[model samples]
Target: MSSFLGRGWSFPPRFDPRTKEAVMVADETDIAESLHILFSTNPGERVMLPNYGCDLRRMVFEEANEQTVTEIKELMRKAILFYEPRIVLNRIEAQLVDPLNGKLEIALDYTVRGTNSRHNLVYPFYLHQATHPVRA
Candidate 1:
């Protein structure tokens, strides 16, 4: 457990006034946080690391349909396989929350490589254009 503890530090550390130290998160929480960071980041957005993110954003502007869903799933599968070596992907589900609103919902089921512990994560992304008009 102590060996795993080193890898369980939370992404956004929480302060503990009594100990004057950051609170550590459980192992599952740490893995979840790492996945969130990986999915949220866009390729080329990271400094000097241009190929670091998933390609889901590229299909966001396209119509939400079967083709879009398939593409998104492939992108997710590739990204996770390439970037996250600690987890083995079990399944990926993607769909539009509302075609009119252009919101997409994605769920990923994975197992931690060495431990074989299963975990699932769902993420919502907005793909619609701004409703309000912008003044020049």
Candidate 2:
């Protein structure tokens, strides 16, 4: 049942030394990782999927207030509605962790569609981003 959730390469790309194959994640773990990727990306990050993300990068300059929380939740809702067809979202919550540090904890509660399994992923968001990124 969970097979419908699908599997993908792990973020940052790990590999097994013996097989020399990329590490993959599946089931609820895959979903959680996908959520992280979706939130981490900006709309134009992917050239093919121009409208694919929640635009968290743009929120870096936003004040960590109620409106910001509302906006973040809405963005998550829209991203999930458009990209993720495997889960039914239960609720989204953004808790201000530290305004001075510009951080928020975003919790996403959802149920897997084919398996009827409930799961939650808590993602820590930081509004403070480094200016002038150094290309490595």
In model 1, which regions exceed 4 Å deviation? 2-26, 129-136
Task: Give the alpha carbon lDDT tens digit for every residue of 22-111 in model 2.
Answer: 999898888888877887778988999999998867777887789988988899899999998989999888898788888788898999
Off by over 4 Å in 2: 131-136
Against the reference, the lDDT scores of all candidates come to: 0.73, 0.83
Q: Any residue pairs clashing in model 1, and if so which?
A: none
RMSD (CA, Å), candidate 2 to true, equals: 3.3
Candidate 1 residue-wise lDDT, 15-130, digit = tens: 78999888777566766777776776689898987898886556656776788778778877888888888789999897787778877778999998768888898877656443
Candidate 2 — worst ten consecutive residues by lDDT sum?
Answer: 127-136
Please report the TM-score between candidate 2 and the true structure: 0.90
* TM-score result, candidate 1: 0.76
